[model samples]
Target: MSDVTTPKRGRPGYDQAAILEIAVLAFNEYGYDATSMGVLASRLTLSKAAIYHHFSSKEELLQLALDHALGGLEGLLLEPGAATGAAIDRLAHVLRGAVHVLADRLPYVTLLLRVRGNTDVERQALTRRRAFDRAVATLVTAARDEGSLRADIDPAVVTRLLFGMVNSIAEWYRPTGPTDAAHLANDVLAVALNGLRTPA
Candidate 1:
């Protein structure tokens, strides 16, 4: 009788989650337009068939990554700390939470920040990003109304500037290499809000 071997019980050493993680890195390092399923397969040591089995297309990966990053931030806005504090206090807490998300979800948010709306997937993401920024800007407006934020500048202008600094963290930030996001946030806000002031 000829010896025969049957296939393993299940797909081993690779799954949807693992594929997503690799995809996130790949997307971040090489912009989405340049990354291909074949390249991903080569990196993962899996066949094109295996990758197709997990995600239908690159767009799915983009959407899923955005969901992972934005989901955390969206949830942070609704927390009791955000809902029940002085406007400036709540805004600061929400901003701190945002810095954490930006650091921890660096890859996803990086992709999010670079999107230019060239494709349906990108346009959808851009829409969501605008909505999120608008909501956060509303909070800044509230803080200004409460006399906590500087009255010299427009709340909308300050909102964009503040978030521009926060969002730029993804570009050059190395979470393990040095300065954590919280300390960075404090320092940036200090220079921004205090403007070279020493303790009185």
Candidate 2:
């Protein structure tokens, strides 16, 4: 008689992207500074060593998550529509694109909105955020100069108010909610542009 042995199966492994998604969600839930690698491992049902295999440190994870969000937003400024059309239309495209990005990357964007420059990683993200804001402010200025938007308000204020409206979505928006990305973008544009547009 011969004896046969069965091989033990190894535990499932998580790739960087999957780990990043879970980590970003946790950061949004518990906050980046508060979330430790052990906490993330627990959330992922993996050992801390397993997570360490993919990410060198928690700050690395934070940087990657912030990059995901900032990349989406900054990329919008480079779109052809952003550069070609009337400043008002370009601004609309940018705002609409931003709404979609927020909806699509809600957790990431949510985490980004919560960043307060507590660390070097956060300060870098803040600097990038400020650059994006400055680009939008320029668009707002162009739109105002072209008679598309109202001139009474400073472009900086308009930029802040416009983004304040857009950024608010991170607070309460849900992917499974009643309003979808397109409709939300439309509602945002209507409320924003109608109010900002110079009256005919």
Candidate 3:
């Protein structure tokens, strides 16, 4: 017998979850439009048939990845901290949760942020994102009503600014570095809740 052990496999043992993870990474690495089932198969070291066995088409993979990101965000709204608290505190909780979700699901969330409504999946993702934004805007409006946020700013504007700050992290955040998700969350909340301008 040869020293090397031969691999015995009919179809490579790949599951849908594992494939979705790699698919998200591939989409993040190569633009969604550029990443094809063939490219994914090559990346996963599987045949086109193997990939197709898990996903019907490349669009399915994209939809799954978008769902992963959007699911995490939508779940945040259901959390106790977000659901029941003072408006300001609840907004803070949501902001922190958003940062945590972004850090935890960086690649998926990054892919989500890059969607341009070019396809049905992208359009649905965009609609979900806008809904999440509206939910945050509702919190901002509540905070303003309670006098926790600056009176000069419109709640809609505040929502965009706060989320814009939080969402921008997906562009540059690295998981291996010194800062963790909690630290990032704190930093985001600090800058967002407290302005840079000093008292005159």
Model 3 local distance difference test score:
0.86
RMSD of 3: 7.7
* CA-lDDT, candidates in order: 0.78, 0.87, 0.86
Misplaced by over 4 Å in model 3 are: 1-13, 196-200
TM-score of each model, in listed order: 0.87, 0.90, 0.90
Q: Which residue pairs come into collision in candidate 1?
A: none
What is candidate 2's CA lDDT for residue 155? 96
As a whole number from 0 to 100, the lDDT of residue 18 in candidate 2 is: 77
Query: Candidate 3 lDDT, tens digit per residue, 1-200?
Result: 01111123354665677778788888888898899888998998999998888778999888888888898889899999999979999999999999998998788889999999999989999999999999999999999889998889888988898888998998889999888999989888878886555645
Model 1 lDDT, residue 80, Cα: 92
Between candidates 1 and 2, the one scoring higher on TM-score is 2
